[model samples]
Target chain A: TIVQTLERHFSLQDVLVGKSVLITAGPTQEAIDPVRYISNHSTGKMGFALARVFALAGADVTLVCGPTYLITPEPTIRRVNVRSAQEMYEATAAAFPKAHITILNAAVADYTPAHPATEKIKKKEAEFAIELTKTVDIAATLGTLKRPDQLMMGFALETNNEHEHALGKLHRKNLDWIVLNSLRDAGAGFGHDTNKITVMDRQETVAEFGLKTKDEVAADLLSIIVQKL
Target chain B: TIVQTLERHFSLQDVLVGKSVLITAGPTQEAIDPVRYISNHSTGKMGFALARVFALAGADVTLVCGPTYLITPEPTIRRVNVRSAQEMYEATAAAFPKAHITILNAAVADYTPAHPATEKIKKKEAEFAIELTKTVDIAATLGTLKRPDQLMMGFALETNNEHEHALGKLHRKNLDWIVLNSLRDAGAGFGHDTNKITVMDRQETVAEFGLKTKDEVAADLLSIIVQKL
Candidate 1:
């Protein structure tokens, strides 16, 4: 009985001893001018939390992050820093082939200034508009290029027809799963400390959670991913 | 032609004047003991930003928040602070009747210790566990209690089946609209400096956004709310 109990209580390390995972985090800056650019409020907390969890699970982790004030969670995890969405895309693509699981958590810009001003434009004009073009769709790109054995997850944040839109992206991006959220919901999005979420897979399985800290959520998510693998 | 050009300009204040709005922010702490508790990662940045936006738009705002490390955004906005999920629920119920628009953003802990330990238990750990019970369902409670004229918005974050799960919440919570996101999506969530989101409504309408600052997203989301109202 003593031996059986001990065997049943194996550490998380015993479960994830040799897995490799990649995660992208924070918001990619889209340069509008030398002194000015566009980005978002992704503080890198969620991604950093994921890195910690994955590392704890004994997976080798590569954390690709955008500009943020957060410190790296672990010394052993590999860190790659980049700025613009284009750079992030290139880095992610380069890292994809080597990953067993990829979490695309970065908030990449969908558009960039078609012609970024070399210098800051003066306030001479009463009104002006900058020409914009679509940035590379990072998740969709990864979806198309993903290995069959590799698990790819995407995120969707919608305001209207929230589910339909998220589903559309899930299908379009060829994701194994997609995490969805909304700005209309209160404590769930950017800059918050706690979150509530649902996990959805290609098989249409859903696992919903109530509010929890990002750390706990990451642990829960990693467990789900490990189970899927 | 000259008269038409002059007529195209409109003051920003004209857009938001005389609106009544209720906003909830932060994370609710469920006390296990006087000194210990359960909570989540809700920094309240997004909700505070929304308050600021609505205030800027000329709305009379009431900001209800759980315990957080954030300052009140405006003098005109009324602020209420609460600790437990029960307190948050009471505060929200009190404020809901008087507001025209409501945004539920607090990350209320789903479970509380069934019977909190009177003092911190001494460490003699072979194994430890705490019995948990469901806390008040803030979103669903409000949804059931909402006035017909009140425009309610909900948020969802999922790891998988992003769209389907968000839609389910939209219906479950009786939200007029929902914001959807996934944990796998980068730069869109907790503690980040930036965000990307989608907005969905009862009509199944969807508005997708690229990465933008939290402040910018707040502005955009408020604009939509105003239009819907």
Candidate 2:
């Protein structure tokens, strides 16, 4: 018991010493009006867990997240808070160049209101339509700018055709590794504290993980990254 | 010090004893698809505060609320959680007939997606439009069904034309009291724990309250209702 306690107390492995890591988390909100917005259910638990593990491993981490109540996992982590997909893209892009490893995990909105009204839109029309425009693709954009030394990871949350879609995104976005989580899986994705992930690499190698706490999943994910390094 | 401690320990006034109270709180989500939704910034602090105060006053409270992480203030208070505005309307309506006092505090959506996709909508189209249909007006419908002895209260959160908009809503919904909070006012409306409010009745009497914590505001509002009863 004493040995385990001692190990726990001084267990900083420093495996990623001198490494600069960038991570994005939570769900981006696209304002429809001054009061209303379009968003998803991401609570940033997975991404926050990833930041914590990476920090524990002695990496200098930068976490760019959307609006969420989740506290910064490590005081050392430089936290950048953004609201919209555009804001997230700008923040992530700015942090990407100096980072050794980049993780794109935020559930960024695909579309945003073409024109957010200055005032609250009154409820008058029987049928109202909100015109939407595609948000900038943060991962794909960063993928192009990635240097040979930089390792990039992306996440795909799919409701159907999970594997095919994830593989498509992996190649399309030019990621070194892709983590796939399905909404069909219970206790996985969005607001859940537990996750089941399948990590796929360019070699078509897939490593599947069982349902586990987000912290455990993060540690497993970090181990894979360390091996590649 | 001893008297103050005794008062704090035995503070239940039981002013609303044997009263049947119905309250709604939080922001109702309107589904755009399986994963995405449209919602307002309501955190339900004020409504939950009202529910807590009313429960402490010995009323039988049924709190029909929208999606929020806030816990039910009292174990004896019946809490019915609803997601969409339509669901909220049905739940509120069902509980209205038995209620002596009904408080429409939830920020119910005015519109909902006309046709929410069954699966996650893939990001393909550069430009998209979400067709929305007007949601049923819960307060107005309940107002028509209200008996002479019943009292109904409603909330108005306005960004512009604050007083006129709130007054219009109060008359249109046939509410006994309308509590107005403006977005322009700092520390008021939506997510804030503190609020500044203007209460108006059919007599055109306006009573403005200084900014205070939601719990204190709830007590003030209830005191007025007690006098009216």
True contacts kept of each: 0.00, 0.94
For residues A1-229, write the lDDT of model 1, one tens digit per residue: 3223223333464466677899999877776554345455566778888888787667899999997768898887999999888999999999999899999888776666678775433323333444557778889998988887899877665556666767778888999888875566578867787777777788767777787777777777777787778
Error of 2 at B157 (Å): 0.8
Determine which window of 10 residues in candidate 1 chain A has minimal summed lDDT.
A1-10
DockQ, candidate 2, vs. native dimer: 0.87
Minimal lDDT window, size 10, model 2 chain A? A1-10
Spell out the clash pairs found in candidate 2. none
Error of 1 at A209 (Å): 1.2
Worst 10 residues of 1 chain B by lDDT: B1-10
lDDT of 2: 0.90
Candidate 1 regions exceeding 4 Å error are: A1-11, B1-229
Query: Could you report the DockQ of all the candidates, in the order they appear?
Result: 0.01, 0.87
